[model samples]
Every structure is written in structure tokens, then in C-alpha cells.
Target: MIELSFAGWFQCRLATDPDPYDEPRGVSGYVHAYAGEPDLDRIVSFQPPPFRRTHGRDIGVAVDAVAHEGIAVPDHPLVGATVDLLDAPKFEGRNGVVADDGLEPLYPFHLQVARDDFRAARAVVPADPSFPYAELFAGGVEFGAAEIRKATGEQDLTATWAARVTALRAELADAAEPLRTAIAERLAFLTGNLGADGGGAARFFGALMRYDYVLSSEPEIDDPHGWLDATDHDEPWRASFWLGGWDADVLCGYARGTLRLPDGAGPRRSPRVPRVTDRRP
Candidate 1:
């Protein structure tokens, strides 16, 4: 199986046992790409850390050099499929709660790639050209950063972040109009009114990780890497295994108007203020 990566988070089980958390039993397939890397080498899934072991509990799979399966981008919704692994696989063993207890070998686990419905994800699109516009979003992010810098009295660090934002804007200059526009508009909304009630300064940074592109704000949080892909409801976004930098737990409260921004060291602790999940309630 080829190690695959993508823009947003994607995780699924071949088995449809109905329990969302249970591992699928008996299935195998090869992945072609990951995060858009066509020449991926290995596909490995590590079990969660044991109470004693901090790292390196790799589950073995039967993968061929040639990719047998292709994972679509967020544009191509991943359809459920069945695959046959070359060999009986070994799962990283754990003690309890697991349906099989990791004792009964579950090979060829049914794999169904799942993700958040693109409709809500599509909310990031910039529908109106007037409402704070995309440029304003960028400006808001800049302004928020400036405020942080002022608070910390770190003129040099602020200057450095400003330059990084400038370069990011330049890089974004080449992106598709819709993507660029949407990012700008949403970001502006997020960073619009800092220390204000409605502005989503915290939310914008939270959703930042979902983006196909990487942005730099702080020295510790700077990553300028990502791709611009067309939107597709069927495709998987990011791998489920990929952890987010921000706290999603706070997003629901923030969106519901129940949470407040943190005092100092705001961005890191208050990662995402917007809930990616549907808020229809």
C-alpha cells in the first residue's frame, strides 16, 4: 500500500460495524498518494501508545510497491471499497475495550474513507465581495499579530512575523481567485475585530490547519507549505491520524458564544474558535 496524504483530515474503516471507534476487521489495500505526494514510499499505521511504551508500535500491512488504490482529494469523495491484503496482518496489541481485544486477527479490514461534509467545509468560501472582503481577512490576521507583538513588547519578532505574512500573501497571489478570495474573506472575519465579540481571531487560526496551504504566524507556528486543489465533496480532506495544532474542544463553545479568548499566549491555547461541524442544532 502506498502512503497517502491530502489537504484535510481523512480516516475510515473498511468494516461498517456501526461503532465509529471500532477498528475494521479483515481488509487491505494500497494507497497511491498522501498530502498530494505521488511518489510515496511506505504506508504504515501506528497503534496508540501503550501505557508503558511512548513510541513505535507499528501495525504491519501488506503493501505492494505499486499503488492498488487511489485516495481522492477533498474534491473526490472517497467511496467505500473492499481490498484484499497480501498477508494476514499484525495489529499493535492493546489490553481492553477493543471489540476483538487485538487478539483475534482482523485482516482485510473494510476501508471506507470518511470526512466532514464538504457543504459545511465550503462555508469558508467567500460568497460576497463586500463583507470585509478577503484582503481585510489578511489584514485582520496581521493586525491581531501586531496586537500580540505589542503586548509582548517583541518588536523584532513582530517584524519577522510581518515579513512572513507579506511573503505568504505574495505566495497566495498565485492561487486561484476563489481560494485566495475565500481565504482572505474568512480570515478577515476571523481576525477582523480583535478582542471584540464577533470577530473570529481565534477561529481563523483554528481553521488554519484545515487549509491546503501552510501559514506562518509565530516562530514556533511557522509552516509555509500546502497546495491549491479544487473543491470536491467526495474526496477526503486530511488524514484522520493527523493531529490539529489548535483545540477543537473550544470551538463549539466559542461558536455558541460561550467562550472568551485567553489572556496572554492567546493564539496557541485558543486555536480554533469556529466549529467545523455543522452548527444547525
Candidate 2:
């Protein structure tokens, strides 16, 4: 279980394929969660961070996870975090290998490739399951390249590396102070990527982190599974606006609330998560 070392963050995506997500009893959104912040600049050195803000778009990969992370397992009682994470992305940019589907990605769902465990996010259960998954609003990017260095194994513990890590930690400490206070004023923290909203045992987030790309999402979510009850196999809904390649950010939107599926793994075989070659952050 790879966890985050920096402050809280979330990664969101849009809901392009609703048949796999929409449901009668409940409909949930997906959010890939990760620790440490991303250096979109260093990662994509040629291209600077987007001057304009973006919300992620819907992803379609087969929707076969959700039960492994010890969360609600969908179709169960709609509780716990309000968002989710999966491993899949269809690139459509000029440089993207996947053809354009005409879906305008609101955020940077560019196709991040970290380790194999790439589907970590928070979810919520709204009063009505049919509603669209809401997107958390964020303020500004609070993490930097140095903070990531501290969190990942990249932190050099050697005399020289230790000095750099020390300096980086100090910088993160100072930077995280205001950010932490800001979150304390509005958000809650949790162990896994499953953040919760402020109400009861369930976790949600007021803000989230965005990733340039994701490694885990739905596989062939549109297909119905026989292992679970028919009632649990409601059509899927939609989730948009999330993630920044592992970095934390302040949220700025809120639409979808939450929903549920069932407690079955189905016959869908899990595929290999995407690998981000030589990621800098």
C-alpha cells in the first residue's frame, strides 16, 4: 500500500461513460489518490503548468477495482469517502496516442504513470444516488518539487542528500503551515485516498489534488457482473474534474455527491497499470 507523505490531496476525472457508472440505488464518482505533489513542469519540462485551470473528464477502463482497498465495495451501504480511484485513461491530445473522442478534459487527466497502485480517491454518498459526482473546489497548488523529493525514496539520506532533504522538509513545513490551516478550516484528513466530507463516519473532501495522468480506473465498467445481485448492478453514472499527477491543490467546484454499487469483484480480469517511464516527481 503506497501512501502519501505530503499534506492531503485528491485527483478527479470526468464521467464520460455513464452506462457503467449510473445506477438506480446509487451512483458514485472516481478519484485517483496519491501522495506527494507533482512537478508538472519538471515532468513535462517542455510545457509549463497550464496557466488556465482544468477539470478532468470521464474515463472508461472496465471498472473492476473498488473492493481491494478496504472501502465500501460499492453496492453496499452508501457510506465512507465520497470519491473513488481507477486505472485508465484515453489520451486525445495532439501528442496523445489515443484518438480524440471529442471530450474536453476539464482538468489535467493527461495520463500519469507512477507505481502500479494508481487508483486511490475519496467518494461520498449523496441523498440521491442518481446525481452526478461533485467536483471539489481547490485554491492554489501548495506543493513544490522539493516537497516531492522529501516524500519519495528520492530523498537522499546521505550527508549531502540528508542536507537537501532537511532543507526540503523545512520548506514543506513552512509551506504546509498555511495550507494545513486552510484545510483544517474546511477539510478533513484520512489514511487512504478515501477522504471524507464533514458530517459523520463517512469521509469526503472540500478540496483535492490533480494528476497529469492516472494508472487505475474502470476497465470495462459497462458490462454487468453475475457475482453480485442484479440490484447492485445499476448502470454507472459520471465523475468529472479531479487530479494533478500526485500533487495537492485547493478545490473550486462541487457537484456530484455519492452513490454505491455492490460487494462483488466480477469476472473482469485486472490489467497491468500504466507505467510512467521516468517520472521526475
Candidate 3:
């Protein structure tokens, strides 16, 4: 599996197809999860970080899960963490192409960590056994230039490279302290991106993230997703944190407060946020 590093800052917006009429537009509003924080001063030197534009399947899945499970969104804010997709399955369809349906593309995609995996998300059991096994979300990890330094074969673990890795780890450790705290205080963390507004377990998860984006007027969302008019401010409403070993503990701690299964078991063992090797090689 190829691993890419993503900084924990991005914008939440409606995923629109550049060609609105000709292509299938994504159904869901989504955040543009970027490789690094958008820097103004670095704009001239900034290479646009490699990013995965959602075809809207992730948001659609979240909406379906919330509706199906009868989940509820909390009145307060919730932190939304991006899952580690190192081992996620790359979705592919026949012809490796998409059909033009005016909605998001439905074929030849990869979705390593989809919103449907959250605890609050329940698969819609179809009356007909074969409903085409459709998955709304697609697209896998998009690698950036940083990956060129990845070591391989006997050339791996050069002294200088090891030093750089050690330094980067140290820097990340230092920078993550405030980011973790700020994230915890600013929003409620989720095992995955499902949100809702109900009681008990439902109170903890829902489609709230999308709710915030749709309500923000700073960058009004187009109406493909049936989003309401602006009702909230647009100042860092949500972000996607890369929870690798360097910051998993901090991120997980923030999420643990409300992230639990219906049986009252801890969420770590749950499929939404499984424990795995978080270290970078």
C-alpha cells in the first residue's frame, strides 16, 4: 500500500463537476482534503497538493446511513478525523469508466475509508439480494511529491534519510499538540464521517459535517445536494486530520468521549477505527 501524508487543514464545499451539464456531478458536499495547509506566502512556490475530489459518493453514503439507521446530529460541534487508508480497498468497475448519470460517477474508483463504515452507518438491506452491490464513495490515496523520498530495497535507510525522517517526526510531534487540542475543542471527533440528530447513540453521530458546510454562506454550495441556504459562518468549520502514529493517540482520545458502540463497548475495536500499524517506514 502506498502511504501519503496529509496536513490537517482543508475547506468544506460542494463537490461540483467542472462541466456541469455534460458530466455527472457529485451528489454530496465534501471537504477538499489537501496534502498541506494552504499557504498564502508560499502561493508562488506552492504546487497544488495532490487531492482526491469526491464524486459525491462519500456524502451520499453518509446521508443514506443517517437516514437508514435513524441517527441524530448533535447540537454541538464534532471533530471529523480522516481515516488511515493505507490498507483500504481500491474500488474498480468494468471498463474502468463511469456512466453519465448527472449524479456522481459509479464505476472505476477507490474508497479506502468510506463514511459508511462508521458505527452509526447501517447498510440498507435490500429486499432483492442483488442491488448491484453499489458503493457510493470511491477513490483511494493520492500520492504527492513527498513520496519520492520513500526508501526501497537495499538503498533504504540511508543515514541522511533516517535523520530527515527523525527530524520530521520530531517536528510533527511538536506541532500536533495544539492542533489536537484545538481540534478536540473545536469539533467532536468521529470514527468516520457519518452524522445525525437524534437521541442516545444517534446524538453522537449524524450528517452534521455536511450540515455545517451547506449552511455556510462564505462559499455558497450549489444545489445538486439539496443543501439549504447559508445559515452559519464560514470560519474553519471542519478539518480532516491524518491520524497516523504521530498523532493517533491525541486524536483517538478526543474521539473516545462519545465514540462507542450500541453494546457499550469501546470504539477502538469497532470496524470504524481499527487499530493498526500507524508508523511511517
Every candidate's CA RMSD: 25.0, 19.1, 23.1
Q: What's each prediction's TM-score?
A: 0.18, 0.21, 0.17
**Tens digits of lDDT, candidate 3, 9-47:** 121222222322212222221222123322111110001
**TM-score of predicted model 3?**
0.17
Clash number for each model: 39, 78, 17
How displaced is residue 79 in candidate 1, in Å? 30
* Cα TM-score of candidate 1: 0.18
Candidate that would win on TM-score: 2
For candidate 2, write residues 15-109 as lDDT tens digits: 22221221211123222111232212211111112321222111211232334224435542211222323222212122112112222122222
Candidate 1: residue 202 Cα off by (Å)? 2.1
Please list the residue runs of candidate 2 whose C-alpha ends up more than 4 Å from where it truly belongs after superposition: 1-9, 12-37, 41-76, 88-281
Ranking by TM-score: 2, 1, 3
Q: Worst lDDT window (10 residues) for model 3?
A: 207-216
lDDT of 1 by residue, 1-281 (tens): 12223222111112112322223322221111211212221111222111111111122111111121333333323221111112222221112222232121122222222223211111122223232112111101112334333322333422333443454466566867655664454233223333347432233322211112111111111112211122222322221111121111111100000001121221233123222211111
